[model samples]
Target: MKNYIFCLLAIVLFSCSPKEQVQTFMTYNLRYNNPNDGENRWEVRKENVADLILNYQPDVFGTQEGLNDQITWLDSVLTNYSYIGVGRDDGKQKGEYCAIFYKTAKYNVIKQSTFWLSKTPEEISVGWDAALERICTYFLLENKETKQRFYVFNAHFDHVGNIARLNSSKLIFSKITEHNPENYPCVLMGDLNLLPETDPILYLSMQMDDSKGLAGESVSGAEGTFNGFKHDKTVTDRIDYIFISKGDAKVKEYKVIDDQVEERYPSDHLPVLVEMEL
Candidate 1:
């Protein structure tokens, strides 16, 4: 009888204990709704985008350059997921959003916030020489099954402003430290608009592990994330990234998904994917 009781207790304890969790994360730049895009307009490419996302079914994902309408459309079609973000223009639905989407059934939001990448991060304002406003959206989420909590940050850096990009990197790291007081396992992904080995990426690499470099398995897919819709094989400029906090988390695989429908690409940028165990 004592042996039976001991076995039952052991089973219960095992069941309640935290289990290692592996999740897929993706970062994509959904080019904003622009009518002048002609063949690659949002309306023409949106279905392909939806299909690709559904096929991969990332547990969590981050998007850049999505406007209010585009975000709403994605939120509607991607029924299994919900997102958190605010437009950079007015802290509402005015401009592009650095949206972070998570599977609704897998996690619950504990806290979420959005801040501009500027000297005055508390308010909505462009910083340095940026031609446009930039922002970062972050969320603290708790896994429904394991009860483990972590943070996710998504951002879009200025394409024209070198100072803005560097400052944005610093600001994001500071914000991560501020928001994650417990130093929870964190994931930062985005269209940073800076090449690898540059100052901004170098700074970020010091603080976090670039998922591509840390993947335990082989990294695969296109060498570059930006295609610019030009079928130029010579174009190899990788700017998109996924960085995880330096912790117990292990990146199992990293991939730059360059999938396209026929000869047409969904967006100007390819999506970067990572499967990690935390």
Candidate 2:
């Protein structure tokens, strides 16, 4: 009788314990909707981009350099996902967006906002020698199944301004610390426009763990994330990244997807995908 009771209690305890949830995340740069891109124009590559995303179906993803119309088209096509972001130009639908998208059925958004990577984060202005206005979009999300809450920050740093990139890194770190006072799990992903060895990345590495280094043997695909629409296999300038708060999550796999259709690449930059347990 005591054995039976013990077995029943074990079963109950096992059933009641919280289970670890695994989620897939991706960071992609769509290269904006420039008509001068010719065969690589947004209209020409939109379907391929959708197909790639649908094939992987990441639980969450961040995109950079997408115009309002481009974002609208993606929002329409990715029916199961919802996104949060604002244009860098006007805090409205004016310029490029650094948008974050999550699966609507799996997570409920608690709070979301967008802020410029500038001296005046609350206003629409450029900062620190940046060539153009930059922005970061963040979302606090609650997983419906486990009731676990986490934050996701998606950003785009200045490609031309070294000082801007460094300051932007500091600002983003501060913002992350400010928003997550309870030390909830955080994921930061984007097209930072800087290499892995740069000072900005080094600063971010002080507190965050780059998913690529954590994946170990599970890393796959190209070593770099930017293809520049060139078929050269020798390109290895990795500028995109997925970073998670230290010890917050365990990375299961990391991949830099270089999928191309008929020898034509989808975009100028490839997508960085990470699978993690949180």
Candidate 3:
């Protein structure tokens, strides 16, 4: 009778304890919706984009330059996932969205919101010297099984503004600190439009660890994330990145998925994937 009681107690404790959790994250820029993109139009390449995500099945993924219809279409095809974000133009269904999607079975969104990367974060305003409207979308999610919660931010900086990029990075850091003071294992992923050595990237690196940099010499896959639909190695640049908050998670693997089908690419910017254990 004593032995049986002890066994039952142990089982109960084990069932209630937190389990080790591993998650995959991907950031891809879908290149927006363009009717005159010739062979690279959204209609022509949408299937490949969906197929790529289906194959990898990232636990949480973010996309930049995705229009309302484009995101809606993806939401339709990615049946097991749900997303949160608003258009950058008017805080509604207009312009591009930096949308973040997550698996419904694994995680539940507790809170989600979007803010423009401007001085007035509350309103639909463009920041200092930015060429176009930019926004960042984030979600506070709780793991269903372990009950562990974390934050994920997805963003896109202005492509043509030098000062805007720097300020945007600072704004992002401030927002993270403001919203997630507990610093809940945050993950930041996006097409930042800046290189690894640039000031904006450097500023962000101070706050988080670049998954690829953590990989160190063990890094594998393509060196560059932008393909520009040309798929030429010489004409490419490394602008997309995935960064995880310091001491929040352990990086297992980092990859720039360059897979193609019959000479056709999924998107102009390659998807960067990071596997992490929390």
Clashes of each: 0, 0, 0
TM-score-superior candidate, 2 or 3: 2
List candidate 3 stretches off by more than 4 Å: 1-20, 232-236
lDDT of candidate 2 over 46-123, digit per residue (tens): 999999999999999999999999999999999999898989998999999999989999999999999899999989
Runs of candidate 1 with Cα error greater than 4 angstroms are 1-20, 232-235
* Best-performing candidate as measured by TM-score: 2
Candidate 1 lDDT tens digits, 5-116: 9999999997876643889999999999999999899999999999999999999999999999999999999999999999999999999999999999999999999999
Better of 1 and 3 by lDDT: 1
Full-model lDDT for every candidate: 0.92, 0.92, 0.91
- State the lDDT at 265 in candidate 1: 77
In candidate 1, what residue range of length 10 has the lowest lDDT sum? 228-237
After TM-score superposition, the amount by which residue 116's alpha carbon in candidate 3 deviates from its true location, in angstroms, is 0.7
| Residue pair clashes in candidate 3 | none
lDDT of 2 at 236: 90
